[model samples]
Target: MAGMDEAVAELAAEHGDLDALLAGLADDRWLLPTPAEGWDIRDQVSHLADTNDICVDTITGGPRPLNEEALKFPTPEAFTQSGVDKGRAMTPAAVLDWWRTSAARNRDVLLQKDARDRVPWGLGMSAKMMATARMMETWAHAGDVRGALGMEPSATPRLRGIAFLTLRAVPYALSYAKVEQPAGTLRADLTYNGETWPIGPDDADNVITGDALEFCRLGIRRASRAQTSTLKAQGALAEAALDNLRAFL
Candidate 1:
């Protein structure tokens, strides 16, 4: 398992990489629609900012903004729409500053936490897991922003956390998809930049092998099985895992 420090480092790197991309964007480009439905580039950053704020509150037992707002909305989708609405109301610079501040605060708080500390993001997760989750989300959203701007994503070693998280969440992904979990364990041998990250039990019967980038994209639903030709799965468990892989709820 990755330690909190390792995961937090990756999270910071992910934030910095995305920040650089956003910093270069023109004011008009902030309005470009990302792959997420009804969300532009600004909306993506807003969601991250808002989510980080909520995460900080959750960790510290402070006022729960997301929980409070959830009560007012009839559905989860509606609650998210409220965030989208809030982001749409802000200027690009404000949205960017909000994200930067919130993201940094989130990292600082996580660094202060013990690795075994559990935090709530709807689900209770270890400090290390939470850090990894933040990194995964930032990378996924960065992909959306890059896609909107016609830029190809630059895969790096940092993706190891995402790939690890996806594999760790196999059962959750299966549950989220309403599919029955397979009895056998599933494994992944994912490669990126000439490095291979092998996840899961050594003796597992089911295995997925492919580029780390494709597997990470699949985990976030940024790419479908058909879209990731480099990916291959063996056994029913592996197939089901690949089909339903998700990085978040």
Candidate 2:
């Protein structure tokens, strides 16, 4: 809750960067494929728009039924594809409008809530946690958009929220993998903006130190544990955590 102010600001900045990235596109460009296989620009935005509605609903006390049919799919990727296929009927303009409006309202509603209030997120999380999750999603998918446009991602202090959340979620990640917590407390000695940002228990032997973007990439599953040489670890839990971490649920 303490970083709520900075987290909200960074979320806004992320959306702004996305807007700048998608400023102009020929109609054909909107139809082009992105890094998410089987998804084009419209599908990517459509997914974001759909989730925006869910975010709003969570805060507004109007929960909708999860798509049971989609849940029947064997994998999360398949579940997503089912929705993206149905969303194909939306013209790009309509999808873009929905996303823009929902994102705006999302900011407004969250700004009015107390940090401790529960938001019906993945499994009931704090308002600040929800906002941080939104930032993670926004930044992760924004990469797909950039890939489609052949542009490099630019970093900002906004990543601070994502990095913090990634480190904090380590315990949950261990549970998700059903792995026993390694024998000691954990620590993250990450560096962002040329300054080291140390977090977690000080006496812990587990340490993960690296570039913020690369660590963020690991959480988003965009990069593998073996591929991120920039990420260094010094304990059992740290090694396993790096391999199994997730920024997105």
Which number leads on lDDT? 1
What TM-score would each prediction reach against the true structure? 0.94, 0.90
> Mind giving the per-residue lDDT tens digits that candidate 1 earns over 119-156?
76655678888899999989999888998899897698
Model 2 per-residue lDDT at 62: 57
Can you tell me which runs of candidate 2 are displaced by over 4 Å?
1-5, 65-75
Candidate whose TM-score is highest: 1
Model 2 agreement with the true structure over 1-249: per-residue lDDT tens digits? 344675577778888887776666666787889988878888887787777776777787655423433357798777667657656887777777877887887777778777888875655678888888888888888888888989765567767678778887877788888888787777787777788877788888888889888888888877888888789989898988897898666
* Candidate 2 residue-wise lDDT at 158: 67
Q: After superposition, which runs of candidate 1 have C-alpha atoms over 4 Å from their true positions?
A: 65-72
Clashes of each: 0, 1
